[model samples]
Every structure is written in C-alpha cells, then in structure tokens.
Target: MLRGLATINFYADDVEAAKDWYAELLGVEPYFEGPGEGGTTAYYEFRIGDHQTELGLIDRRYAPPGLPAAPGGAIGHWHVDDVRGTLDRLLAMGAAPYTPLTEYGSGFVTASVTDPFGNVLGIMYNEHYLEMLGLR
Candidate 1:
C-alpha cells in the first residue's frame, strides 16, 4: 500500500550545482551530503515545507540506464501560496517553463518547469490541501 511521499529524487549531471541551486531556491543548505566517486559529493538532501519533506539530488553518473535525456515523467507538485509568483521566480531562476499556469477552477491552479538540471518541478495551489492543513 502506498503511504505518503517519503522523498523526491532528482538526477543531475552536476550534483554540486544542483545542491547550490536548490539551496538558493529553498533557502536552506542540504543537511546531508553523500560522497561519491573521486571524493566528490554525489548526493544532497534537504528537508523542506511544513511536513519537512525530503528532497534529494543524486549524481547522474549513478543513474540507471534508459533514463530519459530530457524532462518527461510524473510530476509531484508542491503546494505554494502563490502559483503565479513561484512560476515567475522559477523562470527568472533560469528554469524553462514546462507547463504554463492553468486554472482547474475551484481554487486549483498548477504550473511546472524543467530545472536547469533537467528535472521537472511542479507547483500547485490546492484548496483541498490548504483546507486539510487548516490553512485555507
């Protein structure tokens, strides 16, 4: 049975840059750095959001074969207060827009972007999510 999200792992060819970029975006440095080949950092993990969800960046060198060279996969959208502003910020940060802001009505809006590291990052304004957390 599926529980809640434990971690979201993104593969990047430059894990160090990924680490720095994510830290800049999330406003917190990774709490864990895993050493990889040649004594370089192969992994970085950050705890974020109200739930302190785990977000991980792994070196692409360790990625299994058959991985897509482009961003195309299931997206997990993180809840945000301002979808439009976040999308704008992500675009300003050099992330290419993958999905334009869309309104699904009833207080549901979504957007997504492909990070410079070729990973899709989604953001959403979900009414249900906020209501469940007593934030609506």
Candidate 2:
C-alpha cells in the first residue's frame, strides 16, 4: 500500500555536483547531508515545491548493480506555471533536453530533461492539477 511520495532518489557519480545543480534549480540548498564527520557526501536531500517534496541525490558508488546507466522509465512530472520557461532554464543549467515541450491536448503541456547526472526531471503545466489544488 502506498501512502504518497515521500522521496525521489536519483543516482549520481558526483553527489556534490548533483547537490549544487539541484540547489541552483530549486533555489535552495540541501536541507540534509550525511554521514557527518568529514564523511564524503554520499547523500543529499532537498525539500522542494508547494508540497515540500523530497528530492534526494545518492552517490552512484553505492548504487546497486543492474541500475540503468541513464535515467528512464516512469517519470513524475512536477506541476509548474511555465513549462517552457522551466525547460529552458534547466537546459541553460547544463541539463540535456530529454523531451521537447509538447502539448498532450486539453491544456496539458509536458517536458523533461536529463540532468548532468543522467536523471530525468519532468515538468508539466496541467489544468487539472491546478483545479485539483484549487489554484485555478
């Protein structure tokens, strides 16, 4: 049984870079880092968005074998006010374009990017999402 999305973990060969990149994108630094004592930062977490969703970066060194080298499969698209602007900003931040912004009809616009670390980050401007959040 799933309650809700508590966290989304992405693997990166360089956790620090991942942290910095995400910080720049989210406009906030990581709220948590471990395991302390001058330990190499193997993990970093940032609380972001209206819901304060957790976005985590884990060192790929600890990644279990068989994980894909590049991020793929199911994508979780975060709601945004400007899909085109966000995608452009991500690209300017060095994220390669994953999916060009496209309309899914009925006012649903979606796009995605492959972070330097190979994680796919998606953004969407959804009419239904705004209605559900009572924001529209």
lDDT of 2 by residue, 21-74 (tens): 898889899999966335688889999987788998999887888999967888
Lowest lDDT block of 10, candidate 1: 127-136
Regions of candidate 2 where Cα sits further than 4 Å from its true position: 36-38
Question: What is the C-alpha local distance difference test score of each model?
Answer: 0.95, 0.89
* Clash pairs for candidate 1: none
TM-scores for all candidates: the values are 0.97, 0.92
Clashes of each: 0, 0
Model 1, 1-136: lDDT tens digits are 9977999999999999999899999999999989998889999999999889999999999888999989998999999999999999999999999999999999999999999999999999999998989987
